[model samples]
Target chain A: MFLRIDHVGIACHDLEAKIAFFESTFGMTVVSREVNEEQGVREAMLHVADGPNGSSYIQLLEPLSPDSPVGKFLAKRGEGVHHVAFGVPDVAEAMGELGGKGIRLLDERPRHGSMGSSIAFLHPKDVGGMLTELVQAPPPRT
Target chain B: MFLRIDHVGIACHDLEAKIAFFESTFGMTVVSREVNEEQGVREAMLHVADGPNGSSYIQLLEPLSPDSPVGKFLAKRGEGVHHVAFGVPDVAEAMGELGGKGIRLLDERPRHGSMGSSIAFLHPKDVGGMLTELVQAPPPRT
Candidate 1:
């Protein structure tokens, strides 16, 4: 049902500081950045150089609004991993299967994620105690 | 220098129950199990299916004694991801680079990890609040 890790979400009070730390220390390069007006935050992605198996990304997130989810997370937990995302072959199919098991879905349908990927979130309460996200890559061009 | 994800460690109060959850929900199989007396815990690994470029594993760790690190982690954070381990090409080189950045290392040298992999840990304080582990597979046979 799952492919590989799409990215790990990190909530940060200072996104630039975190991004600088990874880039300076590990040589991770920023791949993309975007702002989600609806979510009220901005995100940046850093792809690992020579990453495992040719796939891996680090996501740095900062809340644009004080009341956003990332904002609250940063206020309470400080800078740290916000969630782990697993790459799913098909987001809709995976969500349907999880829904059958009484798992709570954060997104009823696939939504846009960093770097043009489609993603859906699953509540951590249903997935043991770890927050998990389901991500499906956009189909390759023919 | 990383190759792939070795495993995501989850600290659990009921190791068996958590192990069962992944097994039943995702059909994960245990590839290895062990007890690290120094860390004071018994560990069970669940192999992730269709991993990126290679295999991925979920490590469920239960404290052996109440005074163990796993036990203390559980008391403080409840059940969730304790750390993320990435398979590196050279554990020593990675540690040295990280150390140069004043990163606080949990282990000064590479220690034995499950499946004969050499591993070192970085303190969360030095890594933006998320524990990180660097692992290197044993050198290939001649």
Candidate 2:
């Protein structure tokens, strides 16, 4: 089941510039930055505000390679909101349920995603043309 | 300053269908529904999860007229996410600060928005091609 909105992914050609805009205009700060080679994106997560479930993040994603998925998205759509990720209890379980309900999924199985979470993407066509990602956060440290 | 993300505006051709999709898929319930003639859209707000600031909503917006802003957006871009609205303490003050910083605002002044909030939109070109809205909630009743 869905828990809360984890982050809203924004596709950008320049991560630093986008991060700077958010920081200067909205008073947000980048909490973490990393190159996700598997996804072919250099991403930075900006801390926005605290929620009851957790803190919300504005994720800035810059494509590393032109052929990468994010790269294709940028070339075709230009820079904008790419996807909305919802925090769930378990990614695999959520995917299974959605698939069982005849929903099309880009990821039939959960895979590693940014910020130590397992993530699966639902197809845009099936979700009113919005790229929706289901994310399950890693277990809390003991 | 932005307090938190209030909702993500989703443009849909059929408000009821989109509402049903969210209800069945995410187990979310509609918190409120209304038609704003000025905006020329029928909208429904669904409660997703609670945060420290407040609950985030998935807003379904269906244009009432083909010439409406949302209608134009749908005809050009198809159904998908429209804009992201951030909760602010004072819409007027926020507008002044952003304007003073040279941000191109679609709404130079706060205007009446759905759900009893004063809202202003920032141009997409200035914010990495993402249309952003600043919202000030109605004061709490005594």
Candidate 3:
């Protein structure tokens, strides 16, 4: 079961421009940034003030290469929401439950994501054509 | 200015199936449902539990006809999230303010949405390439 919304992924042609748009319009603050070569994306996470949960993030993703997932998304959809992430208590457990239901996962195992979270992706084809992301927060830091 | 998230719109080839999917998966309850003949779609709203501001909703949309806007979305992107809606204090005021800033309005005038909310749409082309919806909640009963 999901606890709350983890983040909303937005695909952008110009990462900086898009970041500025959200920051200026909604007063969002950058929480972290990363370049994921495997996913072919350079991403920045912006925290929304007074968000739904204790924290809500706007994930701005730009294609790192011509053949990256973000690149293909932008090419086909131009610029738009890529996916919606749900916060799960445990990524492995959530993946197992979903898989047992005949769901096809894009990522069979959890991968490192921004802000020290473990994440996995579910294939759109098996989710009623909705790209879904599962994010598990790391244990509380002492 | 955006008050909060009103709902996230998901375009589906089969509204019934998609509705069942979220309901069974997330334990969501339908709060409202309606058909907009002009938009050529049937929509069912599922309230996302334990969400912030009591505004989180999942909007499942199925095209009523082949020429519907949702139909076009499904044809282009398959079944997926189509737009993000934000709650606003006043639909007209928000439109005027955003319009003054040169934001492109998809529905230049406010229209009736489910549950008697007044709504207007902003084009993704002008809003960082992400389709946005502005909704003004109906007055509370005495």
Candidate 4:
């Protein structure tokens, strides 16, 4: 089941500048940063506000290679929103349910994602032209 | 200050079909629906999940005329994410602050928006090419 909005992925040429803009303008704080070589992206997760399930984030993505997905997106569309991610209780279950309902998926199974979460992407063609990601984080420790 | 994500504006060709998709696929419910002749669009607000300050919504927008802003957007880029709206305590103050910080604004002043909120738009050229809206709602009644 969908829990809350996890993060809005934003593609940017300069992650630090975007982070600074968000911090000064929107009062957001970068809580985590990582370079995902597999995804060919340098990303920073900025905490924006609290949601019902957890905090929402503005995920700033900077491409590490010109051929990467974000890089291609930037080349085609320029910098902008790359994807919208929703927090789910279970990524596998959500993907199965959506696939059963006849929605096309970019990832057939849950895959590794930033911030230690299992994630899968739903095809934009089937999701009203919005690249959407479903993320399931590890259960909170007691 | 930015409170929480109020909604993500999504452009669609058919409001009903998109609403059905969200309802069946994401388990969202339509909380509000209206046709804004001023904006030349029919919109449906679907409740996705709640946040600390307010609930987050998926706002489906269908253009009413070919010359409308959304209509032009759909014509040029096809249906997709249109804009992201953030809830704010005061629209005027937020706009002034952003303007002072050199952010170009689409709206010089807060204008009437759906759900009776005062809303202003920031120019996408200055916002990493993503259209952003700031919304200030009337105080909730006790």
Query: Rank order by DockQ, top first?
Result: 2, 4, 3, 1
Model 4 misplacement above 4 A:
none
Q: Considering every candidate listed, which one attains the maximal DockQ?
A: 2
Give the alpha carbon lDDT tens digit for every residue of A111-141 in model 3. 9887889999998877666688989988879
Q: Which is superior by TM-score, 3 or 4?
A: 4
Q: Estimate each model's TM-score.
A: 0.92, 0.97, 0.90, 0.96
For candidate 4, the docking band is medium
What tens-digit string does per-residue lDDT give for candidate 2 at B1-142? Answer: 7677788899999999999988998789999899999889999999877766656788999999999999999999999999988888888998899998989999857888877889999998888888999888887779
TM-score of chain B of 2: 0.95
Question: How many angstroms is residue A3 displaced in model 1 relative to the true structure, after the best TM-score fit?
Answer: 1.2
DockQ comparison, 3 vs 4, better candidate? 4
Listed in order, the DockQ scores are 0.46, 0.78, 0.48, 0.75
Off by over 4 Å in 1: A49-54, B49-54, B140-142
Off by over 4 Å in 2: none
Identify the candidate with maximal lDDT: 4
Ranking by lDDT: 4, 2, 3, 1
Q: After best superposition, candidate 4 residue A20: deviation in angstroms?
A: 1.7
- For model 3, the stretches where C-alpha displacement exceeds 4 angstroms are A49-53
lDDT (CA) for every model shown? 0.79, 0.88, 0.80, 0.89
